[model samples]
Target: MGSVTTKKHQNGLDYVEVSTDLCQARIFLQGAQIDQFTPTGKAPLLWVSAADDYQVGNGIRGGIPVCWPWFGMSGNGGFPQHGFARTRLWSLDSINMHDEIVDLIFSLKLTEQDRQYWPHDTEVKVLFTLSDTLSVSIVNKNNANYPVSLTQALHTYLPINDIHQLSATGFDGSKYIEFGEGPYQQPNDKVNFDKETDRVYTDLSPVQHLHTPTGIIEVSRENSQSAVLWNPWIEKSTRLSRFKADDYLTMVCLEAANVLDDKVTLSPGETHTLTTHIRWV
Candidate 1:
C-alpha cells in the first residue's frame, strides 16, 4: 500500500496528498464546508454533500471534484456507488506554486485492496492546476495488457446566491437523458431550472458558460463529450443528508463528467485524458 501525507503552504492553505506510483489525488478540507472539491490547491472543485437536512444524496455536490468510471446506484457493476476512487486516498506527485497559480499532480494504481472489488491493473493520474484559471486534467491508462472500461468526471460546484437565478450555456440544443426522469430528451437552447434536473449530454462541442444574476463562470473542456447539470432545489436535497437542514440553499452541482452508460475504454498501453478549465468573470 502507498502512504498519505499533508503539506501546508505560506498562503494559509493546506492539502492532503495521497499517492502510489500508479495513481494519486489531493483532497482539500477547507472547500468541504461549501461542498467544493479539489485534488489540490485551496478552492473546492466540487462539493461532497454533508449529512444535512438539505442534501439530496450522500455523494459529491460542489467543487471541481473527481468521479471515477462509475457513479450512482449500479446493478451491473456490482461495485460500490461512484466506484472505489473517491473514498480511496490519493498521493501527490508534484507541486508548483506562485503568486497567481498553484499546480498539483497525483497518482494511484490498482492494488490488492482495489483489485478485489474491480479486478484490473490500471494507472490513474489526476493533475490540478489552479492559476488565474482553474484546470483539472484526468488521465487513465490500461496497463494490464488488456482492454478496460471506466467512467469519470470532475464534478464542480459553483457559488451562487440563489439557485433559481442561475443558468448555464453550452448544453443548449443538445440531447440528454434525465437522471431522475425516464428517457432522453433535447434541452431547450436557453437553459432554465424548475425542478430536480440530472442529465448527461453527449457530443458536446466545447466551452459553456454558467450565468448567474451576479456573474458568469465559463467552463471549457477538451476530450470530454458529456456534462451533467444538477440541482436538487427544494425537495430532493432534503433526504440525502444527516445533519444540517438548510445546507442546500447555498450550493448546486454542475459536473463535467462521463457517467451511467457512457464509459471510457482503453486498450493495453493506451491512455486517455479529460481536461476542464474554469474561469470566473
Candidate 2:
C-alpha cells in the first residue's frame, strides 16, 4: 500500500508527494508537473535541474511540464511560451491507492484571466498513475459552443549516464523538421547526439527506446503522432533558465507532443486525451 500527502516547498509552492511499495514520486500542483519518480530500487527515471528555484509562477526545470493550449511561442507575441497552464495552480482532485499502485488526479479549470491568453472554454485534468512504472495522461474537454484548436506536449526530461553513450531508436523512417528547417526523413536506425538537436518528428512509432549506458528506458505514447527530441548540448544550455551549462550532457527531452499538422481540434462538447507511459526495460 501507499500514502499521498501535500507538502509545501520553501519557495511557497504546494505539491503532492507519493510513497508506495513500488515507487515514490513528487508532483507540483502549480503545473501539475511531476519533478521526480523512482522505482523502489532504481535510480530516478526523470531528470530535473539542480538550479530550479521552485518559485511561484515559474515552470520547474524538469520532469514532465504539461504544455497545453499551445507549445513554444504563441505567434501572437508577448504571451508566455508554452501557454499559462503550467504557471497556474491546479486542484488536487483525488488520490486512490490500488495495492502497490497510486493514482493522483489534478485538475485545472480555465479562469477569466486564462481566457485572455487562450480564448477557450475548456477543462483540463492530468492523471498520474504511479507504480513500478509511471503513466501520465492529460485530458481536455471543450465546454464552449464553438470548436477549438491547440497544440500540446508532455515535455519529459529523461536522465542519462552520458550523452555520448546514448542512442535513441524508433524514429527511423519518420519525417522530422529540425528547428523549422527541412522536413527530412530520418535515415539512421538510431539517433546519437553530438550537437544541439531540436527535432519535431511526425508519423513515428508510438514506442521509443532510450539506450543509456546503464540500461534501456522504454517510452510509449498514446493519442500522439508528433514527438520532440531535444538536447541543448553546450551553448544553448548556458542561456536556459534554471538549467546549468553542462546539464545537457546528463539530460535529454523526448516529449510526446501534438505539433504542426498533428495539433488537436475539438468541436463543441468534444474531448481529447494524450498519454505517455515510461519505464525501465
The candidate that achieves the highest TM-score relative to the unseen native structure? 2
TM-score against truth, every candidate: 0.77, 0.98
Candidate 1 residue runs with Cα over 4 Å from true position: 1-26, 29-61, 76-78, 98-100, 180-183, 242-244, 260-262
Best by lDDT, which number?
2
Itemize residue pairs with steric clashes in candidate 2: none
Global lDDT of model 1? 0.62
| Candidate 1, 67-111: lDDT as tens digits | 675656555656776566665546667866555355667776656
* lDDT of every model, 2 decimals: 0.62, 0.92
Off by over 4 Å in 2: none
* Cα RMSD of predicted structure 1: 7.1
